[model samples]
Target: MWSGPRNLSTAMMYSFAGRGDCAVWDEPFYAAYLKATGIAHPMADQVISAGIADPARVANACLGAIPDGKPLFYQKHMTLHMIAGFDRSFMAGLTNVFLIRHPARVIASYSKKREAPTLADIGFVQQAELFDQVADRLGAAPLVVDSADIRATPRETLGRLCAALGIPFAEGMLRWPAGPKPYDGPWAPHWYNAVHASTGFDEPEGPLPTLPDAYRALSDRALSYYERLAALRL
Candidate 1:
């Protein structure tokens, strides 16, 4: 699954990992992206040290055999991490699903974690680009699932997603033991506290959060890209 930060990507990863048949990977390209861009993040040094900084090696590993010989590999990817110079060829060999939230929500949530996010920092533009790349490669649009829909009606939403991916929906996907998993990246402490405290998807969100004017403007810039994929969501 491809998504921006502050989306429900981690919860979704936990959901899939709850299915015993699947092996989950969390943000494989993050270190490589940080190393290449030299961007300072909350845990930049530790994340780079703990992760594979070589994009080529990361790509190769992504296409390698599933860990533990599992029947399914669910890789949780951050679209923004696929910056320039990273190879996207491995993506063609796997199912690509885009997970999106409203830009206003993304901005509001993301700003709390990393202040003053730009368009690139939130991953909407990169997500759209990746979606188009996959769609063009397959001669059709790949699967798109909204975080809101997943929160509101997880069983039905995930059931549809599983069917599209040619997999059976396991009831286990709806819940998991609260706390971080072994697969979480080193940066989890910085970004995953809320998810770690949850056992499953939360109730459907209330009205969108109010944002400062600067953030509201940022959301406006990302809205089009989000809407493009959202319109095609399962």
Candidate 2:
């Protein structure tokens, strides 16, 4: 699956990991992205040191057969992590799923950790571009899931996703153990605190926060892209 940061990607990872037939990988390309771009994320040094920095190698691994002989390899990817030079051809080998959230909510939640986040940092534009590329290659619309829909009805939405992916729906996907998971990336401490605290999808909070004037345009752009994909969501 491909998604932006803070979009329940980790929670989805936990969900898939609960399945006996699936093995999960968390942001395998993130370390390569940080190394190539020199972006100073919260734990840049630690993450890079722990991962293989070559994008080619990482892409190959993503395209390789499932690891550990599992029937499914669920790779959680971040759209922004695909820097300008990263190869995208490997995407044809996998079933791509886009996870989106309201841009205003994404911006508001993201700003609490990183200030002055640009549209690139939020990743909606990159996500839309990737969605187009994958759709063009496959000659069919890919699956999309809104985070709000997952919160409201995880079982139904996830079942639809499983059906789209040609997999069986397991009730075990609805909840998971709390705290750190073995498949979490090293940077989880900085980004996954909220998800780690939960055993399942939390109830939808009220309305989204209003974006400040400084981010109004950026949020609007993101929302346009989000709505485009959301229209095709399951």
Candidate 3:
């Protein structure tokens, strides 16, 4: 699945990790992204040093074989982390799923830790690009799951997602043990504190994130892309 930051991607990763038949990978492309862009994200250097730094190598790892010989490999990826130079052919054999959330909620949640985020930083345009690419290559629109829909009805949403991917809906996907697992990315400490604290999807909370004046334009642009994809959601 591909998603932007603060989009409940980690929780979704945990959900999939709960399944015995699936092996989960967390942001395999991140180290390569950090190395190429030199964006000073939290723990950027550590993340790059801790994992495979070459995008091609990482792509090969993701595409070549299923590590541990699992039948299904659930890779949790960040759209922005794919970066400009990365080969997208790895996606051809993969069941690409796009996970989306409201722009206001995303911006509000993201800005709490980072300052003055741009549209590129939040990843909606990249997501739309990837979505279009996958759809064009496969001659079919890929699956899209809205975070709100997942939080509202996890079983139904996940069941539909599993059916689309041609997998059984495992009861284990509804919850998992709290705290980090073996598959967590090196940057987990910086990005996954809240998710690491939860065993299951938390009920959607709050008065939706309040969009600041500076983020309004970016949010508007993101909402356009988000709605376009959301219109096709299962």
Candidate 4:
């Protein structure tokens, strides 16, 4: 699963983790991205220390055997983390799914966690690029599902997604035990409170949150990229 932050990604991770047959990995390339870019994030030092900083090793691990000999491996990836130097050749071997939320919602929720996000920080452009890459390689558009659709109708939305991926939709994915999971990355404490406090997808969002002018502008810029994938969502 590929997504930007605050886009229900953790909840979706938990959803997949709830399926006993699937093994989940949280943001495997994060440490490598941070190490390569030197951008400061909340808990940057601890994240780098706890994670593998070598992108090559991370890529290899991504293609390696599924942990615990599980039938399915669900890797939760941050689109922005695949920065310039990281090779994307590994993605061709995996089933790439893009998860999208409205940019206004993303900016409003993300700004509260870490202030003043830029275009790259929010990842709309990167996600669209990645989608195109996968589509070109496969000769078809890859799978995409909107966070809003998931929130509004999880069973139907995820059922369609599971069918596309050639997997059965397990009922267990609809809910999970509240609180943190053993598989969360080191940076979870800084960013996963809302998801950790929940047992399942939250209520469908109300009207898009009102943003200040600067953030509104950023959201406007991101909307086109979001719409492109959204139009193709399952």
Query: What is candidate 3's lDDT per residue for 36-71, written digit by digit as tens?
Result: 998989888889899898988988888877877888
lDDT, candidate 4, 1-234, per-residue tens:
999988999999999999899999999999999999999899999999999999999999999999999999999999999998899999978999999999999999999999999999999999999999999999999999999999999999999999999999999999999888899999989899999899988889999999999999999999999999999999
Q: In model 2, which regions exceed 4 Å deviation?
A: none
**Model 4 alpha-carbon drift over 4 Å, by segment:** none
Clashing pairs in 2: none
Which of candidates 2 and 4 is the stronger one according to TM-score? Answer: 4
Model 4 Cα shift for residue 124 (angstroms): 0.4
- Candidate 3 or 1, higher lDDT: 1
Clash counts for the predictions, in order:
0, 0, 0, 0
Off by over 4 Å in 3: none
TM-score of 2: 0.97
What is the TM-score of candidate 3? 0.96
lDDT of 3: 0.89
- Return the top candidate by lDDT: 4
Candidate 4 displacement at residue 110 in angstroms: 0.3
lDDT of 2 by residue, 157-192 (tens): 999989988999998899898999977889888888
Q: List the residue pairs that clash in candidate 4.
A: none
